[model samples]
Target: MTRRHRAGALVLSGMALVLTACGSPAATDTTDAVKAAARQSGDTVYPAQVANCGRTVRVDKAPERIVSFFPSNTELLLRLGLKNRIAGQTWTDQSPPKPAYATDYRKVKVLAPGEIGREALLAARPDFILADGEYQFDGKKLPTIAELAKLGVPVYIDSAFCPKTTGTATLTATTTDLTALGTLLDVQPAARQATAETRERLSAVDKALTGRPATRAAMVQIVDKQLYALAGGLYSDVVRRAGGRNVLDDTVPKGSNFAPLSAEALATKNPDVLIYHYTGAADRAASEKWLRTHLAATAAVRGNRLIAVPAADFSELRAVDGTVTLAKSLHPDAF
Candidate 1:
C-alpha cells in the first residue's frame, strides 16, 4: 500500500514512515546522524542485507520491473537512471520541472496521489516494490510486505525511513540512501560516483558561505486559512545544511512537523528568510505580495527573502535538490 506525505507533513493511520523529515521526533546531533546513516546505507553486498520496520530482507540479486510508492522513491529511481526498470509509481507532490525522463513517466502507470490504488498497483506486475516503510505496507489497503514476499516480490524500504528516531535528515543520509540503492541495483560504482558529486556540491555551498552570517528562516504553511509553521524533520534539516538556522523554535513533536502558531508570534520573530509550503487547495491565494502585506515589519518582508518550496521537497528522500535550491536562495553566492 501507499501513504501520501504532502498534506503538510502527512501522518497516516497505520504503520507509516514516521522516521522521515515529516513526523520524525529525533533530533540527534551531527555525529550520531552520520553514524546512523552509515549503518543503514553504504554496503550493498550480495544477498544485500536490508532492514526496515523491525524486519530484515535479503536482496539476492537486483530487481527488475520495480513498482515504487511515493515520489521520493520514484525520483530517486530516476536519478539512478533506472527509469526503464520502474513498472509503475504513485503519489507525487509536484511533477519535476522539465522532467528529464519525460518518456519514462509516460510509459508507467500511476496510482492515487493520496492513497494506494491496489488494482492498478497489482496490474503493473512488479518484480520488486521500492516502498517507504512498514506503515506504507499496512496490508489491508495495499499489499503488505509479507503479502508481496509471498508472491515473490520483496519490498525494499528506504532505510532512512526505518529507524524509529533519527538526528536530522541530512545530505549524508540522502547520499547514503542513494548509494545503497545503486548498490542494490548492482551499481555501487555509479552510486559512489554520484555520492562524490553530492559531497562536492554540499561542500561548495558551505565554502561559498564561509564568511556570511547564518540566515534565520521561518517556514510557514497557509492551507485553508489556517496558519502553521514547519517545525523539525526535513525542513529543519535543509535549513541547517544550507548554512541557515530554523527559527521556529517550539515544543512541537518532530512527528507532526506542522505546528499551529499565532500570526503575532511569527511577526515578532521576524526571521530573515520565509519558506511557505503552499498547498494548492487553499481558497484564498497565498504569495509574495500576500506575505509582504502580512509581515511588513519582519525581516523576511524587508529583506525580500520569501522562498517557495514544493511540500514534497521538505522531507524528501532525495534531499540535496532542496538543499541546493535553498542554499541558492539563502546565500545566492553559494551557487
Candidate 2:
C-alpha cells in the first residue's frame, strides 16, 4: 500500500486505541475533550494556558499566517501541509534544507535568525507567533509575547522544545498544536490527517525496533569545527523511539543542554552508531573527514556507520525525519 494509505489505516487504529484510554470526566466540554485526548496520546494540546516568551497566554482561536522563529516549527507547518499559511520563519532552513520540500518552503518568507523583532514580525502581520523561549527577539530585549499580545497578535510558545520541560513527562509531540493550527486556519481535516500519519509512522518505526538488541547511538552537531553533543531532548527522544540507545541520554538534565565533549571522550564512549547534526559547510564528505580525524579509532567511524540529519529535524516537529533516518541507519542490512 502507499504510504498515505497505510498512514490513514494506522491513524484509524490509533484513534480507536486512544479512545479506550479516555477516563471518566467531570467535564465534557470541548476544552476538556481536547485535553483528555492530548494526555491520553502523549501529545501537546491547544486552547490551553501556556507560559513562555515571558508571558502566560491562553490560545483562543486558530491562527492564519503563523510566524515561527524556530526551525522545528517551520517543519511542522510544512508537515501539516500549511505551507500557504506560513508567513515567515527563522533562517535555519537554508543550510542543506531538504530538497524535496524546498518548493513548499519557498512559498513562505524567510526571516533572519535571532532577529524576530516585533516590528519585523508585525510587518508580516502574522496572526500567531510560535517560538521557543530561548529565541531572543530584537536584540534579545523587545517584542515579548505579552508585548505582542498587546499588538493583537496571539503568540504561542513551542512548549515541545522549551528547555525547562523537554525530556520530562511534560514533553509531548506538537500534534495537538497541529490540531489547533488546523482549527485556526480552517484546515481541521488536513491537521488531523497529518497528526494521524505522523503518529502512525513513528509507531511503525517503534514496532520495527521491538525485540531487537538495543544498540548505542550518539548525536553530534558540528558548526565551524565545534562539535556540540546533544543529550536528551527532542532528537534524543527520536533516537529512543527509533529503537536505539542514546549514549548521551543521561549525560545531562532535560532540554537542549549540549554536553561539550572532546574527540577523546567520543572515542572512549565508542557508540555502535553515530547520528550527526551538521549545520553549515559540512556536507557528507566533510562529515566523513571530521569523523575520520576525530573518531577514527571508534567502532562507529571504523565501521562507517554514521548518519547526518538535517538541523531542522533536530526540532520537535521535524524530529520525525530524524526518527526515520535513525531507523533506516540501524536496519540498513534489511534493505
Q: Estimated TM-score per prediction?
A: 0.74, 0.75
Cα lDDT tens digits, model 1, 161-190, are: 554533244456667566557766755656
Give candidate 1's error at residue 322 in angstroms. Answer: 1.3
Stretch of 10 with least lDDT, candidate 2? 23-32
True lDDT of residue 186, candidate 1: 59
- Candidate 1 — which residues are off by over 4 angstroms? 1-46, 132-135, 254-256, 278-297, 315-318
The model with the greatest TM-score is: 2
Leading candidate by lDDT: 1
